[model samples]
Target: MAGDRVRERRTVETMIGMYCRGNHGTSAGLCAECAELRDYAFSRIETCPRRDGRVRCTGCGVHCYNPVMRGRIIAVMRYSGPRMVLHPIMAARHFLP
Candidate 1:
């Protein structure tokens, strides 16, 4: 469970970081848009019912995120997914699964 939470955080950070870097040209952290999404994602992760040993969000098909936030996160993942190969460790830790 602890590891899953860590994995979830790493996944959100990596995706948000990548999205912000490409879309906002920032590398130090997320931009305003991505930051908001990141905060929402972190909150969801913290309260995730499946944290004990769970299916990944993308595959789980759970509607954990609200519609608007879900759309935002999907966009972030789309833009950042291809770029994940660059951050192999973080990608392997959570993003891949």
Candidate 2:
């Protein structure tokens, strides 16, 4: 539901923020590249047909993103996924079973 959508949005935002800060030296807001990715991610999340709370985008059947965007997001997640522990709540939500 709505809570799931909000949680997903927050999770992506946190991951993108961590990636932007660490990789792009952005302290307060996203860089232009990160901002574009963030916007694309948010839009995709909003339009995703599979709204199942248990089904993460990584595991979903849908291939909603274009190739370039998919590659970009994959990189972001790969970089930020392990670093999520810095954010305790998001880390738990993301890494816990």
3-59: candidate 2 lDDT, tens digit per residue? 888888888888889889989999898999999998999999889999867787767
Best by TM-score: 2
Each model's lDDT: 0.80, 0.87
Evaluated against the true structure, the overall lDDT of model 1 is 0.80
For model 1, the run of ten residues with the poorest summed lDDT? 88-97
> Residue 29 in model 1: shift from native, Å?
1.1
Clashes of each: 0, 0
Worst 10 residues of 2 by lDDT: 52-61
Root-mean-square deviation of every model: 2.0, 1.4
